[model samples]
Target: MFVGIIVDIISAINMFTGQVIPARRWMEPFLLHNQSILGSVFYVITYGGRCIQGATATILSFCRVCAVCFPIFYQKLGQPKYIYTMQVLQLFGGGVALVLLWKDEYEYILEDNGLYSVGSDETNADWFYMFVAIMEVFFVVVIVLNNLVTYTMFRLKFNKKNAMKNNGVSPISSQTNQEKQKRESGLDKMTFIVCLVELIYFAYIVYSLQINPYMNKRIFYFFYNILCVIYSTFSAWMLLIVSKPINTELKRMFLIIGGKRLTRSISISVQGSRDNHK
Candidate 1:
């Protein structure tokens, strides 16, 4: 996810700079000769990022299900090092496959109106769309199924715990059960949020594709590009928001920074007042 963000930042910089800066004599030859390659690289980066996001969300949902349904097994699976290793491998493999498959789908074309744009070959474009549809379906199915399983397991556990309490179970065991329930509930909510964001983003992609044939206006094209960028960026933000630990840490960091600044300001004000009085 961090790597995806860095790639996106670089791509955005290259995109805007490439447009605003006039083509130089030395650069024109390279651009003209390698436009297709450049287009392929961009296409891979864009869709590769989406693949990583989808995979991350799916993995998270699965982990939530495991944690709720099979606590004992999840103890080993949920270790930070193991999870991080899996994430790294998943992203690396998915990125390579996407680049190999979709890189050739994009081609650079110079229109008669003197505008240069990246155009997709009709056959390859259809394949790309099909690939995206498959990914969306896979992600949604995995997330929904995992969420259902997690919820079912949580309910069973909750009821069992309650029955134990009624049977005069120790207070410590009841407290531990309650804590476990709370943690599982948080994971469930986080999974739901991630799934919701994925669905919304998928819907937007479908809507845009349907309206694309009728969008001949340049202003609409500009807005479409902006929307693509926003959607790509929003995925990372959604992950951060859905993560309880990360959100808590971010809030704590912001509070500490603000408190420090306030204290410094107050101390400076007091020092200035004393100096003036002296």
Candidate 2:
């Protein structure tokens, strides 16, 4: 929630600097011509939430896969310094992207004229597009590698379970073995879902920005909104489901509450018994 709030604040600053500030100075040329306040609010809420949620989801999934793939190294990754370093890198990268994107209204150029055809201006735009392409490729590669590692872990766990079962381990003694298999299966399914979603998002974005030159901005906006909302909701739901610690904490809370109620009832009954005896 804190991360999401920070993302929202950052995005709000970006919007204010881009639109509201420019509007105040009568610099209408810098504002998005088609942007209404309603549209802006909708875009910010959806996209801002999506950015934070997506990053959190991806990191959580990566950590799970990492734990299975490299159990020995997982603890090291959780060091405060390392986690802080990662956060700083994420913020820095986002800041750079925003600066580059907002420098001279590059989005307006793309929105109006579609993909650049040819010329110095077109060449510069192409450079930016290619940069985005390279980053997308890198991201997709990481996702693929993560999926592979997780699936390998799943197979290893399955084989281990089979071996244990063949050795006639008691079911009670092997409860953890069974649970591990379930966890692997769930993680495998999650990997597939995440990869599929990422592929679809990349395909849509590439098509909107590069392939379909004649596509309307409204259509692009519609797809972008749908894509982001799906990503955000699915990402959050998956984490909530897969995170055993979260479930355990919830269970612990309930148990504490139940225990207190039982204790109170027992005390009241004891007092009533003493009174009757008296």
Candidate 3:
């Protein structure tokens, strides 16, 4: 959720900029205009978020797959040492990308879709497109493979249950197993929704910036902007929808807060009424 919030905030900046660019309702915000600090900052944030979020999702799926298919290494990966190492790596790598991208001021020329590194070399335009393409393709391949394997495992479990029933044997499920299954099911749904939304974002980026570069720029840019806003939000909302625990917690929290406020207001009103009467 932390990562999601930060990514959404940065993406919102670009979305806001994109909105202004078209309607010309007001002048461009100084921070986000072309070749400005915000322009480069947005690039690093978006690109880093894009790559890191996808990688994070993949790592989670990979961990689940390890739990199912490779229990030996799963334990190792879940260890505090290993987990901490991975977290450090993500931060370190993201920092590295920040440095590489911001080598000089003009390295990242923030245009409509936020993918051009137009600094000192014209040929690098195509390079940025290719880089984005390559990163997205890597994520897509890993995500699809992990999902397919998970689906296959689920089917096998279903078949085995059917076979046991047919053979006049009852398959026992422990409370622990049931709980784990429920959690996994929620996670599967959440990951699937997030991945689907992200894929749509990636596909449009590739198409507009790479595949069909000559398309109507303004219209495409506007649509991309809309997508940025959508991608920023869809994950967190989907989590609340798919995960009963989180949804319930949020509801309970809000209800408690509202009830307290209402009770306080009622007490204040009653005191005022008593004072007037006296």
The candidate maximizing TM-score is: 3
Q: Candidate 2, clashing residue pairs?
A: none
C-alpha RMSD of each candidate structure in angstroms: 5.7, 8.1, 4.6
Off-target runs (Cα >4 Å) in candidate 1 are 1-38, 78-85, 92-98, 101-116, 169-183, 200-255
- Any idea what lDDT model 2 has? 0.59
Per-candidate local distance difference test: 0.63, 0.59, 0.65
> Candidate 3 deviates by what RMSD?
4.6
Count of steric clashes across candidates, in order: 0, 0, 0
Alpha carbon deviation, residue 135, candidate 3 (Å): 0.9
Candidate 2, TM-score vs. the true structure? 0.65
Per-prediction TM-score to the true structure, in the order listed: 0.65, 0.65, 0.74
Give the Å error, residue 143, model 3.
Answer: 0.9
lDDT (10s digit) by residue, model 2, range 1-278:
45644664555454445433433434444344533443334333433333444454456567778788778878888799878865664454344344433332222333333321122244544555565555555556677777777788779878987898999999886887777667666667767888888788768757765788457754665566566556645745775687566667878999999999999999999999999999
Q: lDDT by residue for model 3 over 1-278, one digit each (tens)? A: 36546757766775565344424534434433554454456456556656665666666667767877888988899689988776664454356447655553553334554433334533554565576677778777777788778867865765675565567653354444455567667877876776687678778878987779767645775686677777777777777887778888999999999999999999999999999999
C-alpha-based local distance difference test score of model 1: 0.63
